[model samples]
Target: MTSRDAKTYEEAVEIVLRTLVKAERIKPTQYARRLVMKEMNPSREARSVSAGLLYSVLQKRGLLDEVIEDVLEITDDVTELDTWVRNAARIAVNEVVFEDGDPDEVADVLHGLVRRLANPGAAAIVKAFTLDLKDYEPPEPEDELDRLKWEYYHPRWLIERWMEMFGDPDEVVALLEANNRRPPLTIRVNTLKVDPEELAERLQRKYRVTVEPGRFLDEILKIPEGLPIGEMPEWEEGLFVIQDEAAALASAVLNPKPGEVVVDLCAAPGGKTTHMAQLMGGEGKIVAIDVDEVRMERLREIAERMGVLDCIETHLMDGREAPEKLGREFADAVLVDPPCSADGTIPKNPERRWRITPDELERLPKFQYELLKAGAEMVKPGGRLLYSTCSMFPEEDEEVVRRFLDEHPEFELLEVKVGDQGFDMPEACRLFPHRHETCGFFIALMGRTG
Candidate 1:
């Protein structure tokens, strides 16, 4: 489709739906990335908004199902609607049911867009769907899973797994809602160039945005609003790096000192790798390893940009076998941030939930446990091993750690102190969105006591 001005919110909704349709046809997870890459003069903020809206809509599938039920009353064969038509209806319903946008206006704009798109068959579908918009009310959520499905916009199976582990259904529901909102924009300042607090003061003066120090990363700046990091002067000079608050905590937990050898297994997109390098004051050896060549390239670029060149090394290899490649007891510290179901990241990528299943959930703990075992082998005696995942599921978090400790007596869990972040995990620290005001994450600090 050609680019057109979205003069009204409806037109904007149409554009978003069309994009999601295109993205779904290609690959669901890569949809937003593909769109952002394709835009010639993309406004990062606008794209972020579109992506957020699309994710929010997809996460609330139960609510969308209700919209479909209402539409079925006006017309049969809703199944015959094309991709764009279905997406348009979803967006309209999302605005009305989820975002609390005006129902009548949403319906009118949805109708207008379908007509303009000239898909007469789809327009008929849109018209039929819009007929009883005034009377449409989403059904109240029934159980804990349903509450999470509506509240956090997560799939039911995910909620079930979390509820089984957390035990408190309400807390799980609250965490899900927090994930659906746009996460705060956080950056880790380069202490090599400036102090984080000092930089925050300078940035606020220039951009008219407030900046605060992040809880864990002393160098992290929490910018409530400002230019995209790429456009900021600090970023161009490698004065700071954009990272999530939970992710920044990984390096702090590792707390690698200068002149030590640190290994990061599954380290791509290099957030923790670079953070570890920074924590070491760029004086230590950091071997950043990942299996994906494409991501390794990204790791290389980030390492270069962050100016941690002398201390950082990139390795493209299967992380499961990384210990064999590096030999046993090779590093002073090891950070294992393995691949996961990414359920905790649903707020960032709503389409991800639809891609996961119970079987997939069952398989993750084994993989994570194996990786942790492999990572443990790479740390020297008395050295630290920090295991982390951006997942709140017990199978991926505490259970895996507990099982690992049971199987391997050589390593012991280290208690983490964050001065009121939350009560410490017996074998790990868990950060939930509702409680920690960060992504739902888990970090286990372990030392090779043997």
Candidate 2:
């Protein structure tokens, strides 16, 4: 986190590539953003560009890594090399293939990047692959999913699963590629603080923020490129919060009423919880719970910033404890946006592409089931429970909701409607990245019919 850590673009890439390797070693519960912050205290100006590189490189690391291994296989063994060396090779290969620059200059810069940051022994290995990386190509796999996994930079198991569900390899490929693209930065206007139209007018006419009404909701705004969102005066005044459109829809579906009791079981950094506060006109009680105390504190901060502190109560307890601690049938409405494999929003946070394994992520569905069931238990008869995940995997989405319905016959999937664009299930819907133009997400609204 010193001035020497990330003073230039190549240096920044080096630091991130090194951290990327380290991030893979850490637990899935940890985030790479924190690792970057700790490793390099990049100044605001530096971070704008470097953070983009760090994320872009990491998000594409899966494909870049495949290419790197291919190059390593040509001359040496990847496993025999130091972890940092492999990461460096991936970054250099990513630059060679994807970066729009003078190819030779890019290669020269990478050589210098490795020489500066790598150990003497590792530098030789990285230098040996400099030009050879440009010509490296992956060996073809006969298996359809294996081919898609190599081409699209996704886990093979996930590709196979999606292919089986869709019955079309081409369709699954589109979804996988969509996750690799950089999604538009979107935000929801804080209606409690400012009028959406007026806020848009001010942002557009004055601050030059080009915002359009979102596809699903008028309150949400799609902020275009070329503007720093955090620097906007509206953001400082808490007139809006950066959130994905799918998550905004989930909160919109919950639709808490004024003075009603609501619980956001997996709420952290308070996106939906605060949005619920806005929907309730800052009049309802919302208990926001998350296991991470730091994020829970940020949730409180966001609530206060959005001028909705009076409505929300933050709790630093495990989401599993919400039903027991808050008492069963306590809330009029509940939202359990539980943690999943994060398949839906990878375009925005691309590091997820390489940071998780299929086996490592298998536990997501079981925990998602537990949280949804807990949220269901917390809803009173006639009240609603909305179970959502930023993932499109059937096991983590519809199947969990389906099982919950079977086990708790008292609850039935509520008829949640969207335009014909959404894949309508009997009681749930899956918003796909390719089809919906939103992060891959699933939501099932259930009512305690008993």
Candidate 3:
């Protein structure tokens, strides 16, 4: 590539990295999208390259930092640099050592990018770091859990917990490997407007991208990655919504009926809420509740874009308050998609593997159980209550459900079979990235028994 072309790609990379460094614990892809739109609109190739690098740096951050520290030690530079320079070094190491890019080409582009930040000395550090990165071996932890965590690019505590849960270290490795890989781009067809086949044809014709029908649901479709599918005309016209297969299956398991009143606790960004609307033929009332104003606004926007806003009543309130505020035992069905560590989403949000802490893991299940109880209180006798989470932890999934069932004699576990993919509980269901090629998820359906 020409020097000008290379410089343009580096600029895109710099813009994305600048934003990414500050967006701690937030979805990096959303920030990347925001920056791409607001800042310089780079070419499609540049966006693709930058996005690949951004995810790579985020995913393998631990290893990259190790390499950078090793190089810094060798160069005898103890001075702490700015977060931007450190991030730049991480991106450079990811490109040169892991992605096997042309080292000299990466060095040249990185120098230009770092120069823009007015850190000429930082550029020297990065250049040396990149050159020596390949030869650096990440220090192996003596403990088995720590070694596995380092090897798999996950938290040591999480690796140990998974070992306890699965009782097999090899199985944990398989799951970790799946989480490290880039997940496919999956979207659900707004069947209330267009069928999957027609939407697939339209997407292919307009975007010139391959669209595969999802394995679990007919209304779901998977598009090739890095297509800027959100910018498509169909998206703006409310033809489909980007959703994962496992998430769609949760709504399917609930199977909301037409004219029924359904409650969607923890419903922000409206993936399951909109799916329920479609299943109900847009004929039912969906009471959606979330605590965050920003996320609730996002839910409204998505519901509007999917043409299901009219069927959804959004409330910016804690789901635990739904029982008192919205009344109890009124809704025909309730979906409790409470928050958790979201370990199952690691494949799509790689930074999550490192972001979740032991304390957070302990706290999430308690909150999840409360959300499930609130949803249960809103379900009428004989009504269905589907509890689900994008978490691989039993503490957040099976254990929470177990405790709820133990405490609430009025609720009985009902069967929730989704083809061959099933949870250990005969009545519940699960989807794993290694097995199901979808986000790791858990679903348990219960009936309010008077």
Best by lDDT: 3
Candidate 3 local lDDT, 1-450, one digit each (tens): 787777667776776666565574444465555554455656777777666667777788766766777777636332276665777787877787777777777777677767776578877766766666556555759888877777777777778888887798888899989988887789889988898999888878877888888998999898766357555688788888778999999999999999999999999878899999999989979999999898788889988988889999988899998899989999999999998888889888887877788898789988999999989999999899999999888788889999999999899988876733344677888888888889989999999876
Which of candidates 1 and 3 reaches a greater lDDT? 3
Query: Largest TM-score belongs to which candidate?
Result: 3
Of the candidates numbered 1 and 2, which has the greater lDDT value?
Answer: 2
The best-first sequence of candidates by TM-score reads 3, 2, 1
Give model 2's TM-score versus the native structure.
0.83
lDDT of 3 at 99: 73
Model 1 lDDT tens row, 1-450 = 223434434434654766666676554444344453455235554555655666667676545755675666535543456776777777777777667776666666677777776577777677666655656766778875676576666667777876776788777767766766665667888887788878888888887888877776677777655345545677778787777788888889889999999999999878888888888889979998899887787777877878887798888898888878878897899999999977766655566666678887688889999889999999999999999888766778778888898999999988876522323355467776677676667888999985
Q: Which 10-residue span in candidate 2 carries the lowest summed lDDT?
A: 26-35
Give the poorly placed runs of model 1, Cα more than 4 Å off. Answer: 1-11, 18-52, 65-83, 99-148, 350-356, 419-427
TM-scores for every predicted model = 0.82, 0.83, 0.90
- The C-alpha RMSD in Å for every predicted model, in order, reads 4.6, 4.7, 3.2
Give candidate 2's total backbone clashes.
1
TM-score winner between 1 and 2, please give it. Answer: 2
Number of clashing pairs per prediction, in order: 0, 1, 0
lDDT of 1 at 95: 74
Compose the digit string of candidate 2's lDDT tens values, residues 228-309: 5444677778899888888899989888999999999999979999999999998979988899987788788888889999
